[model samples]
Target: MKMAKIGLLLDEQTANKKWAERENVFAFYMKEVLDHFGIPYQVISENTDPMEEMDLLIAGLLNESDQAVQQLISYIKNGGAVLHLSDSPKLARWAGCQVDCGGPGYGYPAKELGYQKPVRFLKTNHWYRAAPADWNAKEGFLTDGSPEGPVIGELWMTIMAGSGKMVHCQADLPYSIVGLQQGLEPIHRDGVPAPDGTAGIDDGLLKADDSFTMDWSCDRETTDTGMNYFSEAYADRWREVFYHKLAEMALEKGLTVPFIGRWPAGIDQIATISHDSDFNLEESAEVTLSLLKECGIHSTWCMIEPGYESGMYKKIKQEGHELAYHYNALEVENGVWSEMEFKRQLQDLKTKTGLKHFCTNKNHYTLFKGWGELFEWCEKEGIQLDQSRGPSKKGNIGFLFGTCLPYFPIAWHTEKNRKYDVIELGFLTQDLNHHALADTTVIEPFLEEVQRIGGVAHFLFHQLHLLEQPKVGEAFRKVVREARARKFEFWTSEQISRWERARRRIKIDRLAPSGEPELSGEAPTASPVIWVPVPKHANVLGEEAEIRFGHLCIKKIPVFKQAQTS
Candidate 1:
């Protein structure tokens, strides 16, 4: 039996033009998620791509191209499984539905798919409303307020077409994922006040909070008045649903979907501890460094300009931790958000420490302006990762930027298919010690959810508060203990950057006759583990790996195999 693979049909001409105009590149974001999960797939074009060779097809159609529509309908009619990622009228008609785009707004999942957070559907021309009774939807989106309200549209529906299945999404899946993660184009600064003495807002700059594009007011009845999301990592759960559906569809077709697990050696999940050196205080930095060493974990210390004495830098390097850059773009500190200023601080950190390279950076006060500009600067500076997109206020702590995983952001206002080289690992929140709202309780749930979805759980701390604030020190210890209890490995930002980049080079060569996937590429320092979803009675010819999440019998395979080229 031939192993199944996912085929992503992308309308490049239309997607390219849309991306250039700062529109959601549906294909790009969909592919981004697939690549992030290490799902093996082939990019197909509508004109001459072979659809029969694919076990499942994900159609990312941006326009109502007649040729593409006809091709998809024919493929589905001829017993081909299709997962449509567009609201094209022709494709919707084939799925027995009508397109009633009742303008852009928030949408709630009518039925729970393990995630109940309202997904944002703010795309300009392609927003949707609930499908009518005639649509015969299996699962759909509801009005923002309640699931009993008017049906917005089908969230996930399947129709049997010519002995095959057509799974459809009413809203644009790629757009929703991209919008939730990257956030909307910042128009004005959000007026939310920062913590006392914090430089989050009122600084006359577009801080990270200003870029929040998710509707925090959607599902807030359960939480206290101060909190926004009922739960965190909304995008992470939604992505898991997508992955589950893919596995379900593949299983239905008597096939298995293969992907590389996020972490190497089958670690349950990953936890990263990073400290922002705001004041460049040596004593506080030493305190945190000692605590980390005591816990037997390596961390990333983001250094501000004139960061530490040369000896302090040498000490940090001598330890198993990472010395990174902390870009000071806060105006109150006389910082400027200019490219020249970014370069100056980075250069200063490098010069002072005699460090030839810095892999990660987090802006002072989580400051950010515009879309993709900070990412562009990081890429230009040869920095591999950034951590400036998390929440600064109390209400929005977990998954504020919609994900804890490291993702390469796409260029919104630039040329087509342009994605930055830098990886964004948005921290969950800063200093769990400061607020009653964000305390030690947030750590376990966040790590659980991240483990459930095979992503990272990044916790941020401040060097100044570690010892001066005893509660802060306690909170840090609690995080480490809980994560360690859950078998989560602690890694530095540089380690994550290197691992992600290395895993991206890995590709599924082919399925062996024994039902194991053959992988090709240079394995990371820790060998990569490939996950294969095994159906009942279907043998997975490999060692069964223990993972924290998923009901399916996921088998793990080695990553050092050579490609079996025909």
Candidate 2:
């Protein structure tokens, strides 16, 4: 596929680098913006020759050399699209564009542009009629304004220019600058009339107008608008700009193009669920099993053994759901339970409920204190998996330290000289814990990480929380539906165990390790438990009300006599 070339000119000196690194500013926007457009772009020092033949040049705030400035002029003259973010107007003026100051007073430069004044579109007979009306206008000082400030004409700094053309504000357009043409076809941002029949906007000298008002009825108020919220309109504008830049670059280079990703083929994703209470498990298990049956999705559910409701264990087993123990040993606050007691309780629960495999509780954020001890116990007890690694606050210590993907726990000889069969299956970020640090927007990047590493994404959530809020439930359902639609196979914990066992056997056959005796028969076996409950509620023909669970319906016999006879 033909890829469009994009170059970023930024001044990454020591001081700026230090500041950017601390805040993760550049890294966050740079990768996201590039990925959004599917455009392959490279960042270069501000001093690099801008006149070099390229599809688009994004000059940062510090490219000030006369030669470098002239190079940008040449780039524009050669028909290359240029984006100057924050302080780039100085270079813009050198490129023959006239900048007129709009709005009142000098404003502070924020990371993303924040406008204070209402920007009214003059609506000249220009090409960009499709642009959104009434932008929140702010001031950009005129390129050649006198020390005092009134200018004849105002430059309404709106993103969309003429003929569906849009210039991204703050210079750094956040979207994939490549693949944009392929994705958003027919929309281009290059070579529209510059509002003035000239090559670029004129950099006329002007003075600021403190009392300019297009509408006298509207009060002029100044308030700080926070971060840009996600909107379809914004996304569209970004997509358009990205594609236009890419198309312009593609035309410059002779290359064959192909669309990204195979259509109709599913993209792989991981499905997971968290278990908090036994009632939570029972409800989730029933719903999940039914949903999976209907949609053919495999999902994992984390279980809290002691915390689970009575009779829930057998139900989970019958439904073929994976069971991982949720450990809250660290969160007791009083530190009442000892390491030995925790292990004993887990083993006892396993024996009583017939659950062989399990994972720790999400409450272990306090510390990973007893993880090593737990692993030792698992090795002795023949428990197979432990999906409890990752950040947590309830647990004072982290557990299953080494492995990222599922793997056998490193053998640590205890004082008692015992081995364990526990393998640590890592989790994706904890929903509550991580969300407390970032926001929902981070979910996409997290998914990308999982895809990149070919890892299973383990998500933990409280059923109560999900069910309590309709919006949250809908969002949760949407994420799951989207993931499934993308071709991710969901496996219950039991299913994962089965797959892992089969995978291990295949590996064993391939390796045939010395001193390790080959298994003479199929893997270990356990009887499946099934529970059948008597029907308590039923409908009868011509009956106005439903029959109750304890009450038997009979039209011919008196209730007292029938009970006595029985």
Candidate 3:
């Protein structure tokens, strides 16, 4: 069986424009999702690019012209698969129904999809109101539970054209994904905190969660009147479900889609333990460092103003841990939030600690203002990774930002929709067993999900809490041991940033006519692996190959090919 060649179809008119300026930026976001999954694909414009070469096609948004629609139909009829993301009534017609605007409401997965709760969409989702051309065409629907309740919405409609098929999802999936991941521009600065204290929205300051587009009351799933674990990473699950559908389609076509594993070789999952040295107490930090050493973990320590003495800094560095900066904007004695203030703190960290670079940073109070401003500052200051997007209150403790994966934010508000240089690695929660924080209860499920999805799970704790709170220290030790038992490798922010950057540099050059994948780029450190769903009897060219996580994991993609098993 030949490896599948996937192409992301784009509109000819918008192909040359900046993603933000393009009439339909969904395809670019589709590309972003693919890149995050480490899937191999190419961009093909509707006018000039030939579709005959691709086994699978993903349309960011459809080119709704008659000729384009007819051409896509013909391709599908001839056995090419398509997973269309846009809401096209014409395409809906082929899928056996007419589409209409359905949801400004939440979308709960059908029982068969195996999801626990409903996920919210930022925009109106596509729904089929008309009688279907084919009664069996609709495979997935968002149904309201009342016995007399109407079937509110539909997610996927599978239409088989002669020898092939097309799965049309009426929802603006890419838009939802991007919106949930990066969040909306923080224009609404009204300070009104949650009554239950799940979110401290009344503080009269901007923060990362403030930029969220979803309504906190409706979007977040809460327990005990919003005082515990808030919600699952709905956005992350959406991505996972979408990818599984794509993989299923490819397998049906006798093709396989290979992707980059989130962690390095043999590591089931990865985690980062980051501490904000809030009081800059040498004794507190020393106790925390000793605890980390006992656990055999190397963590990232974000230093505040008037950081530990020179001796403490040297001791930390000598112990193989990472030194990072914590920017305070609390408006206390020296608290400020501005580009100038940010730079001053960064420079101070460099001068005082004698640390040349601070690749990772998290704000003092998770302080943020406006969309993309912090990102722009990060870009200017050479910060490669950020950890400020996470749950600050005890009530909102899990996947509040919608992901555990690190991603580059799109300047969707900009004229060109440019991408930033930095990656945002949103933490799941902060400080276990502390005031306004969930204890180890938040850890097990969160880590389990990350392991299932194969991404990094970042845990944040203030150094003061570890020393002052014994239960918090016990919780930290338990988390480290549990994560290790689950085969999760503990990493520093610098290490994570380095690995992700290096991995992004790598690309699948092409899938050869002979069905082997050709890759190009500098190899990532610690013997990272790429996953391929090799057809039974297919041979892969890699130094070591084994089947794991439902795919074949290859440590090194050897330049030569091997004969198929007899």
Tens digit per residue, CA lDDT, model 2, 1-566: 22335676655552254354442122223333333222345676645443365556555334456765565556565555554443344554542343332322211122122223222211111111233334333423221122133322212233322222223232233211111111111112221212322111121211011101111122111113211111111222333333433343343343211111101113233455544443444555555455445555444555444445547666666666555555545433332235575566567667766766454333243123322555655555555665544433211111112112343432211221112355555453333322222224434434443443334545555554444443444445555665565555565545545544543331111102211112222332321111111122433345322111112221211011111222
Cα-based TM-score, every candidate: 0.88, 0.37, 0.86
* Count of backbone clashes, every candidate in sequence: 5, 53, 3
Return whichever of 2 and 3 wins on TM-score. Answer: 3
Off by over 4 Å in 3: 12-27, 65-71, 89-97, 104-120, 124-129, 132-138, 143-150, 161-164, 191-197, 213-227, 509-518, 534-566
- Candidate 1 lDDT, tens digit per residue, 344-429? 99998888988888899998878887777888888888999998888776666776666778888876645464678999898876
Write candidate 3's Cα lDDT for 139-206 as tens digits: 44543332123556566667788888887765557777777776645535844456565667656767
Candidate 1's C-alpha runs over 4 A off are: 16-22, 94-96, 102-148, 191-203, 218-230, 435-437, 536-551, 562-566
Q: For all the candidates, what are their Cα RMSDs to the real structure?
A: 3.8, 24.5, 4.9
Give the per-residue Cα lDDT of candidate 3 at 128.
61
For this target, which candidate reaches the highest TM-score against the unseen true structure?
A: 1
Tell me how far the alpha carbon of residue 76 in candidate 3 is from the true structure, in angstroms, after superposition: 3.6
Q: Candidate 3: deviation at residue 147, Å?
A: 15
